[model samples]
Target: MLGEERASATRIRLLRDVGMLFESADVGWLLSERGAATSPSLDELYRGLVRALTDLAALPPCETDSGDLPASAYARVPDVAREVCDVLRVLLGRLAGAEAQAASSPASARAVVRALAAPLCVFAATHVQEQPWSSPESRSAASQLLEAAVRASGSVSVAEFLCGGTPSGEQPGALSAVLRLLRPQMTKESWKRNQATKFVFSWILTRVGRPWLADHLDHVFASSLLISDDYRTENKVLGVKCLQHIVVNVPAADLRQYNRAQVLYHALYNHLYTPEAQLVEVVLPCLLDLLSVLEKPCGSTEMTRRTNRYDQVLRLVLTHMEMEYKLALRRVYARNLAVFAHRMGVVMIRHLKRLERVIVGYLEVSDSPGEQSRLSILDVLEVVLQNTWPRVQSRLGALVRALLKLMCDVTADSGLCSPVAREELLDKATRCLLLLDRYSEGQIRA
Candidate 1:
């Protein structure tokens, strides 16, 4: 009935009628011998579900830039699609629930789930590509329905289906096919499509477990790299996040196999060269996590062997910080610098020359209205002092001068800062000064 040549509204009404009938019927009764004569057979209900899904999938692309569809048609498309999805969700939920309890055996339940995988995956992918037509509500319904369908399959996870079908190779899963369909849409010109594609990939990544992800690392890794390499900063940040997920999900041995870890390392490292503070901010933490997994201690000489990757990243960050003049980027670098310093520990002394210049340069200027960069730099200095006080003592004179100058500068701009923030800076500076005095044997006072 849904596949007939009828208006979208008529088809939706038919779907709603089917949904209402199912919603009113109890699953156990529907599957019971007594109600079996009155209620639709499971096979008949499954066919109706497929038809409704087909009606949904047959909607024209709602792209504004594409087809010359009337504006009225475009406006009506999402409403019609959302309604059909709502009905399909209800119908599928009832059918799946009934099938789980009604199946003669576990194999039968698994067979039904496997049969539904292709259609469900296609439908979910349609909703996930939500920018042009599907509403958020419809997309959410699709997710719930997909989950329900998988849960009914018992013992087989969505991840298992995605990684490979059924272990016996009965049929190839939809994940690879979905990726292929979405990849062409991830172009620079079609940003909405690109965004939608990423969302779909994110959904897949979330459902997949480590064992599954490890087997299909290339698919996940390649998609992340593609997004990270996009010209857009937002996509780049999301791509980094996806990579972070992969780092945590895939085991170290697999990540290091065929130098996959190094490839990821350089990808993130290349992102740091972009001047966008937002992208840089996300890349740093992801890099930190990836580094932990990629690099490991070999033996008793672990301490002596320098973490060259960390040092390389630190050097580049310090270089950028030294030359950075923008308040936002400086603030970002300063904030992250403290984190790196803490992680580096005494390894921070490796970049003392650049670090000193950055510290002095950052302190010389006033970040009015909040002085967040100065506050973060103060934190970095504190970490430096705590970890490398012996090396820091030699540079105490310049550091003390910078600290005193910052204190006087903060006082000079008293109106720029709230009383609370001003006091905090003063307190932090005083602590740094006191540390210098203590470490330098009153050299700061001198």
Candidate 2:
């Protein structure tokens, strides 16, 4: 049996050889070293080589003799690249451990977190599909490392991260590197597209004119599958909500030049017609939010040859004004329609009597929507009537009369079985009518 002393010496000698090779900066040797360290006695040597390669990767951009080599050349080989990531999980643990000792080594702790950004990103992006699943321990370790890095670099707020931008104080090249690796990971069911939208959102959330950074910016946000293209694999609800978040974060004028942008506005347009009731609640408000941001007279010949995606944008919303199937979806339908009418202002509501009818129809006693759902629809009604009161004034006389009659009836059913639930529903309806009456000049029409 090899004594512990002998194993330690063997580990030391093998590590020296690995160090010398790294000094030469000839990456071709990493494969050979990993292959040679298979013997149980030399297990530490394999671990050493992994760390050495990670350090080599995280070093500031060095000018090696291989000028012709692509920046991504090291990762082009799948086997070698994957070993680097396996080692990366180890480094993440160390970084977390160091950061945990805040009083002892703060500067060194911060440095590890900062230097780690590039290597972690590069390893994550390399042939990710071909890589073996990182063990549970490794996954937990990586998460800890990320949290530590985020804590150390307090420059980026949590909100900014969701918008697809890095923390404020990050070095430019490192920030771009991180986003590139983050893009393809967001489409899985756990796409966290809610937070996932940030990888791209950070780029154009402000007005972007940098053509040099355009390629990176485009890859991360404008062309990402999670936006609307990768619906085949993504959870549509999560993706739509993330899309809504990005729309909120993106600056108006910066995203304006292309309001009907493919997969941006175009994707939402396509989803509206598809029978996904789940998306009805979220996508409609976002579509209207988008129109409020768009340049006027979209797609006209006089405009800058715009895709006029906004034309489809308006046409689609006006066409599908209601969702009649589920109580929850109907409530969502009312909410989205109200927000749209309110945002478009009276000029729009005054012209589209059909929209007002769609918004008001959810209140009918015969539809029988659930108690909680009915209350939610009422809340939307109050906002819609409040925001569009001037336009709705002359139009909703008979509807007001029906609401008054519903208030006086003691046996209102609307499909709710529990008496307590029915009471709650009626209470909500009464409040909605009162708010509508507030703006009715003390005499509701009819």
RMSD of 2: 12.2
For model 2, residues 41-127, the per-residue Cα lDDT tens digits are: 222444344446644323123243221234343332333333344444444444445456654454554454555554443334222
RMSD of candidate 1 to the truth, in angstroms, is 6.4
lDDT of each residue in 105-211, candidate 1, tens digit only: 43433444555555666566666555555667666766676666555544366776575645444555556655555556555455343224566677777676655
Best by TM-score: 1
Q: Cα deviation in Å at residue 337, candidate 1?
A: 1.4
- lDDT for each candidate structure: 0.72, 0.48
Candidate 1: where is the Cα deviation over 4 Å?
A: 1-11, 17-77, 100-110, 117-140, 143-147, 150-195, 207-212, 297-307
Cα lDDT of model 2 overall? 0.48
| Most lDDT-accurate candidate | 1
User: What does the lDDT read for residue 233 in candidate 1?
Assistant: 85
